[model samples]
Target: MTLRSKPYHWLYAFVLIALSAFSVQSVAETSMEQTGELQLWHKISLIFDGPETSERADYNPFIHYRLNIIFTHPATGDRFVIPGYFAADGNAANTGAESGNKWVAHFSPNHTGLWKWQASFRKNRFVAVSAKVDAGVSGGFMDGQQGQFTVSESNKELPDFRAAGRLQYVNEPYLKFAQSQTYFIKAGPDAPENFLAYQDFDGTFHNDGHKDDLVKTWEPHLTDWKKGDPTWQNGKGKAIIGALNYLNSKGLNAVSFLTMNIMGDDQNVFPYVDYNTYDRMDVSKLAQWEIVFEHAQSLGLFLHFKTQEAENQGLLDGGGTGLQRKLYYRELMARFGHHLALNWNLGEENGEWFKNHPTMPQHTNERIAMARYFYENDPYHHHLVIHNGIDYDDLFSADSHYTGASVQTHKADFSSVHTAVKRLRDWPVINGRPWAIAVDEPGDAQHSLVPDRMNPAHNNARQNGLWGALMAGGWGTEWYFGYANEHSDLTAQDYRSRDLFWDQARHSIAFFDALDVPFQRAKSHDELLSSAADYVLAVPGEFYIVYLKDASHQPTLNFKNFSGDFEINWFNPREGGEMQQGSKTTIQAKWVHKAKLNNTFNLGLPPSTPNQDWVVVVKRK
Candidate 1:
């Protein structure tokens, strides 16, 4: 038995490690020196203040930030060459009223070590330039006194984490893919502010004090809690976190919490926030909310909520005038403060309309607002994502910064792995951020309500997340009780999706964690793959995964390079076990893509007969 056979439990161990040596230049090869300026251009243009998620009293206000600059050399610490603040003058004068902050900066960092700057700013008229700006470009802080970030968004009253007179941005830069103790989001030039973080701007908190277990905030109304009517148990926040922590202990990184997920919108003639009614929202259940967050925090799991990424506009259903919807979004952002969870997906699969016209005025307006809301508010909370079809590029701006997008590529059933992975990688490189995929495996084959498809999608999604640019976390497949009749008896098996989800995620978590660190950082070597198509590779450093679906017709494996000694192990995702390793010397000259959505791998033409269903894991010298 191989280590991949038995599933491992995550205990949720985490340690905060500041980045000491990062080759930012090594990534993307897109040099900022070419794009950004260093002369003290116009600096007085925008303001970055308040808690992250702030909404204007009526209209969300635009922050005017101006940076006056000057830079000295590194080694000699010599004469001033580059003028400061990117010379913040002579830029565009007019910004659309509906649009927000228009600002820029003149800053330069020469090396990969800690870089610090003393930045001070003045807000609109009222306050003098009194804000502190001991900002550091590297992982360190303005100085030794302020490198760490303290969050108090959950509480009504601020905790005494900082000194009384200390006023700082409650922003945690989500400048990386993986979630950690503080912050979410990987910094890029996608969203305005060109970043994603959490906040309500003026430091808003709805919970009176805070439940001891608030893992992360959710709209207290998400669960089905009536007015003191306890039918379904309140979601045990702590238990959920504890369960997740256990998963993390075993190697799981994080979870995609269905915080505001509601029932089907497919059936509704007019869309509504599908789950329990809003009037039935119970504030007392807020206690339960804390417990959930506490558990998540304990287990080193970061929360990626499902909804409230934008306003619950009831049902736009075409009746929503563009102005009406956009206006509602602006206001909703002000109210919800454009925040919640790591990935604030606006909605689930609403169908062709949502996907087709992604940047339609209403959608773009809402999307832009949401992006800014999170960026201007809470960036770490802005690991933005949108769940739906394959063409993720269309879902987001060719340059818009959305929550990291993902696809529900139901493996075997809906699509193939290779196809799904292609879409995931290309989405961000050509567009913004990156996309994620899920291995959509079906446990209840006989009882599948929708189209009973499965594999290349599932396996590919997992591989892409583990090895692709869009850092895939665990599986995001559907899980729940199948549709039922009036007199249905609920059994544990009834929720086959749940069981399958837990099982698949548990196993796949092991597979993903086994591969690489900074998985998203791996460059695309798709060019060095099989030209014929039946097989594709998700290659990391010293490791490569060849997803073969040659079940129907025998495939001829032709590759560019497969030299020297290597160990090949097959992993049977179907049987939930591992296969023995095999030695390979003769490289087949013909292997074309053959697997379909149902994952029919027909590998029985010449060399060997079929054994167990397994994914080949290779360790090459």
Candidate 2:
């Protein structure tokens, strides 16, 4: 599909203004760098002049001024309907301006070639309804303007998001990068839920000790901050950028954060003008956040954007369908939708968990509406999933916008990770589409993946916590800091607290990627294996991957109706090592027409490392 020019094309005159790294044009005013140095997947902003505004409190500029830049990549004929936002001022990051005429359309080209674009700016009058109603003929200066630009090859270093091109959801169980066409496997921190509660951010959490205790300086990561990296208003975000640097240095690829946690734990982070306000967004604060997120993207980190924490489920626009909720969703998609890799989690532990709270709880239909709204409005339609309290079954529907499940468990010892992932992975396939399931939060309610000083071995964690999820065909696992530990989930300042556990997680991700295992094609089947401690993920006779918790005994693989010659390789799970070569094996099925013995063979293979955990890989030869 291509983004064709709007009607009345002859009325507006197009002028090719000289730029450094971008090409921009409009009827009245345009702002963009020259396209000579643009790279694939690098966010480039095309600024345009709009109506001047003083207050966005009563009427949200996000919903009222709907500016869309329809971009068409010439080489591939791929079209992207990118949203535009009202940037209070062109330099909102430097100067804290809440209202102005600076409007912008951010674009990150998936392909390296010339791309054409046109803007469709409209004014909607209603703030109560979700649909758009025309506000007469007169509009902003840059409405219906068109132009084109070019994108060069990415010179971005490895482990950087700019190097990955666009991260797209291709109706599969995982997200894939447009450049390499490789599926992503996430492994990182899911805690420090208040990751955005930075000291420099323009907000205060000084209401109570619970909120104030979680305020972060990010001091440990200060050394990782580079000279030319994104820093706002002198040195506002060195520490937060440094935190992402620390995560990338540790080989972690994803991080989760609550953008708003009003009336909840760490009630510090919100996009509103202030803690009490909800109509308008804090432009300067959001701009600073963009700096942090942009740096994270450059580091190749997957942003798991947890939009709302539990307590604020009904706080916005009458529990989802009202104008407040619509405005919030539209603003998020407008500002950050151009990001290469991210997921908009509807709400953390969403649904009616709080009965005695002041606000009305969110109903099932409201949650569905929220997801459906994002599915319809967001042009990118990046992975849209909802976090759960306990009951997530109602949210699963082929018609809904939930592309995956971000599960949270209360089970102690995390023994439930395997079954939970298995069921979630299998149930979606039973539905119309497959879901990319991840155990975002797992383990006990207390002491989950604490410092190495407390739990160094991490036997339960390695065996049940990490391996169980992977063995069940789970996409990835992120460590959730428990409440009972020091620097717990909300108050974690240093990421090194769970350093050893990260090593184990990275080893698992490396094992699959290095082997080039067709994990997406594999299915988890516990019925094929005899031992309860053993888990099998196989693609029939093509490939079989087995994970043994107790490697002392061998597990039987019943090749009932299959005949194939296979090569076996074993990998140590606890201690990361190369795939050890094993013997070639054959499984013969029963034969009748050929006059052969009518019998099947059940192969029992010995463990590579006895009494220790191991992963056995069998490939058809």
Candidate 3:
């Protein structure tokens, strides 16, 4: 049966809840119900019969109670302590319930074996905010419940996260899949950050009058949603889900969204029951979000969770990692962190880059504190990054725990994307590790990635932004729609607005994948080329990829110290296909003076388009 139909099994388990009492010890006497496809990398949920609570409870179920499960793979003794949340009615996504006695924890087992689990439910005033496991007194129901289940090998295949396992940071310039060990390159849209501010969600954001004009219906993509996908409240999520379908159809693989944007650009998105409430979560709304996230995972989409924006970065505890901020992170982790591939972005355009603004920007210490919390708490230890408004100097220090950088450049033609990516990839850290850099927002705010109709050729973007980032050792890029243009970031509801550009992005991504480029081991070596206008990524004597913005410039490669014959092939970044032979197909190494300026081998011109951008691949034959 499908995942959406598995919740029906909870009905048979709820029968045990009727026998349990509210007393602390009595709840522990009951048995825990396990639901979900019991397989590797699939979501395994453990439902408990806990104390009854509502979203509007005076005791505040979110902050007063905590549920953490210690899941262990007995064979290897590897354990993961995952956080849990209160799932109202356990079927909130379908029933739209606001209260229930069900508390649940979701876990994705990485190994196939007999896994054991134990729940540590606790309660106290503000207990959920603390990081210590023993912070509060024993919660009455299922406080010390123990259970075990079996996980078999996953039956999933390509494009599904289950097949590749978790996406992890392995101290390299790109993320790698735990199971496949294949390096990843993310290319997708970075705009419409308020993607979750849908009118169909169970929230008041549609009529909240807070940037209400920015609310998205995603109407244009509704036709993209296929039958038997997923929807909530009886077919409510078709448009948003279809939008993801459209992206995946274009060969894009990542999407960014803000979990909470209160007091930010679009205030419609948040997890709270109301706009002002921070402690109480909107259970049904979050459940609906889970349905969408699950689908994205199956479709091979990397989730970039921009937790907050510049305006709301300091909204909780004045940017300090205090009670409010900790609870917020806890809820987010408990609800969505179990996904196989995702990154926890601290904030979008965070820090004090704006002059004379009323924003309370996060200081160096506060930023480090936020990164530290995610580093210590998240079980999977997903990639952690912070977007920069001015610079990443604060996180460049030895004390910072960030694993990557979300770059935003301010160039209208996106000319700075190459330099920005190279700067971050070469930034020296105390640990001596390179950061996985992604040019998330490439161009300036005024005209970043304009609509396809307005700029059909996408000359500047394709030449400078897309190829620019890739040729500079960047892991990938996500285009940001400028607010000054049509189908702007906050106002975009159709993915087709930039249809032509998506093909260009797909061509770039497909080149590396189809050609089996060893990008993870390669570094940007523009100095090895003859012209400053061109870019080159190479592993020295093994492989080389040169991006010539103007193919007419007969730039040469420095093969002074190289000692093997190499074959050259040209790839069209504008239109992807099989690699074609260039004018000069081969170059043999020859002895030359080390101090000579002309020791480089001539790189012959492209067979056809000498004026447009082209990528040349050179490998030792």
Candidate 4:
């Protein structure tokens, strides 16, 4: 039916939500022959988990989401009628195991909406009833067998259990949150220091933050305490204090305190413990963090409260049936909304988790979504991020718009993140957001692929744009990788090498300060490489940056549509930034680069004789 333009004009408002759950098994795999190298599986999965309510936390991880699907054809019709296709689709498993005959749906009071759903298996069909999804605020539908259960209105006021933190959204307090590095140590119900032998801080914190602590790691006073002696723990605290005070003493702008329930029994510093919510002590920032943040403020350090999530080994005895993941996070953000010192660190080394248990994806999404949620809607609006392991390229997807990307990658973990950082930078998924690498390598961990005492790794990553985010308002934190020796009665001095490494890591920091770079939000360009070629980008009114794969022989070739007087600043990863003032404009200079470069310019370098790559940043003419 057609209506007159003015005759039909009217104001209207409505919301309609539809919940349809269906299960589909892998159909016969379609085999497509390839004439070239084979790449497979374009199967995309949307993730979900059981309702994230603390009450069901005993059965459901409060931080988990179901691997659910809600895909719209955008051009809806027969697509809606497909058996396994629903407005909201999901995996058969709720959290751990598959539910034979159940699904959840939500519908909003809507109009002009017509749809259909199908399933490969009959039992996977969805039954509907009214339930309240407090977070989504959409009317919920469940398997018809259970009837309907109403959430007591009073229960709405019940506290939403959450990670330790204060929410800061857009510099406002709209939510609460937590951050921690406990995945590297312990979890849930113990003091963070108990499980770890010590911390490793590089020289950047020197003078500005932990400079003195870098010196104190070698100070003989730390070993004075012994087991069964009150002084033993006191001595550990002293060591911690020395390190912390160094940050206070330095003019460093911010801090992230390690907050988690991890048990430390002296000798074995790097062990995970099991502790539930109640079993875990009140070591959360709610109590002790205030003092730390306050002290940092007096010394002028932005306080960033940190915590971690359900790292399995660190006992999570939180036996609740329902927990409001969103509200819990909001409450944390709301609690500490006003403090600039609070940043939401969802987890450390969490991005590295392999999706072995694919059905448990919602849990993964929930954890990841925790950071996404915090960064998206928090009040404090402080920097919200997740700690990605070295394999960031595989795990970090382009979702969420936040402050920056913080990573924990060592030499061992750092398998050419160029592609990963490329995705992190230019992948269609994540438009180029800021990126930072918080290196904690060459430390006390004996098995480190990149040892803790290795300081060059620190500067190398920094100068190479791994930590360039630091230059672009990107902030990085360095931890001295260490562990307590439980088997050795805590007498092991495994930290010396790394301690010395931190003392020397300052060279990188000083290098960063002197270099002219944009870490957070710099413009990037795409160009083809030929040194054997090079990838080069010429930023208008700025520098010409180039990243070469192999620097065998240097040839100044022709640049299409490029002519100007340019000064070349070749990036020497070994010696830092060196500028070679080109007297003439036909620029051909030997330079080094990190992650190589976003721009690939052709350099007439010989075939794979194998020379380390370099970057040339041509300053403004």
Q: Which number leads on TM-score?
A: 3
In the range 1-621, model 4's lDDT, one tens digit per residue, is 333354533421111111222211111221111121111101111111222233222332212222122223222431211111111113211122212122222211011233222111111111111012222221122211111111111111101111222222322111212331111100010112222233322111224321223222424334432343221112323343333345433323333433442331222121111222321111122222223333334343444444443242122222111233443443344334434334566554453355442112223444445566655544234666555533444334666544444444334333333333344554333444434323222222322222344443443333333323222122344432334422111232323333333333333343444546432224334332343234444444345455543455453433434444455554443344344422233343333444342232333332223365554555545
> Each candidate: what lDDT?
0.30, 0.76, 0.88, 0.32
How high is each candidate's TM-score?
A: 0.45, 0.88, 0.94, 0.45
Q: Identify the runs in model 3 with alpha carbons over 4 angstroms from their true place.
A: 1-28, 592-598
Candidate 1 residue lDDT tens string, 91-196 = 2111102122222222222222332333232233211111234321221111111111112211111111111111111211123322122222211101010001
Put down candidate 2 lDDT per residue, 1-621, tens digits, no spaces: 222374644433232123311222335455433322477787778887777774364566765667778889877889888777778876788787878888887877877789999877776564323344344332446666778878888898778877777777777777788888787888899998989988787644544344676678988878878889888888888878888988888778898998888887888888877777777777878888888887888787899999887778888876866778877887788778888889999978887775675466777888889988888878778888887774777777665778888887766688899998888887745255688888888887687777777888788888887888888878888888898988798878888778887888878877887865677778787777778777888887777788877656666665545666666777877777687754425544443455555343333443455677878887777
Better of 1 and 2 by TM-score: 2
lDDT of 2: 0.76
lDDT per residue (tens digit) for residues 152-253 in model 3: 999999899999999999989889999898888889999888889898889777787788888888999999999998998888999999999999999999
Error of 3 at 223 (Å): 0.9
Q: So what's the TM-score on candidate 2?
A: 0.88
Model 1, residue 89: distance off in Å is 48
Candidate 2 Cα outliers beyond 4 Å, as residue runs: 1-26, 29-37, 54-60, 74-77, 127-130, 133-137, 204-210, 354-358, 428-431, 582-609
Q: Where does the lowest 10-residue lDDT sum fall in candidate 1?
A: 187-196
Residue 431 lDDT in candidate 2: 51
Candidates 1 and 3 compared by lDDT, better number: 3
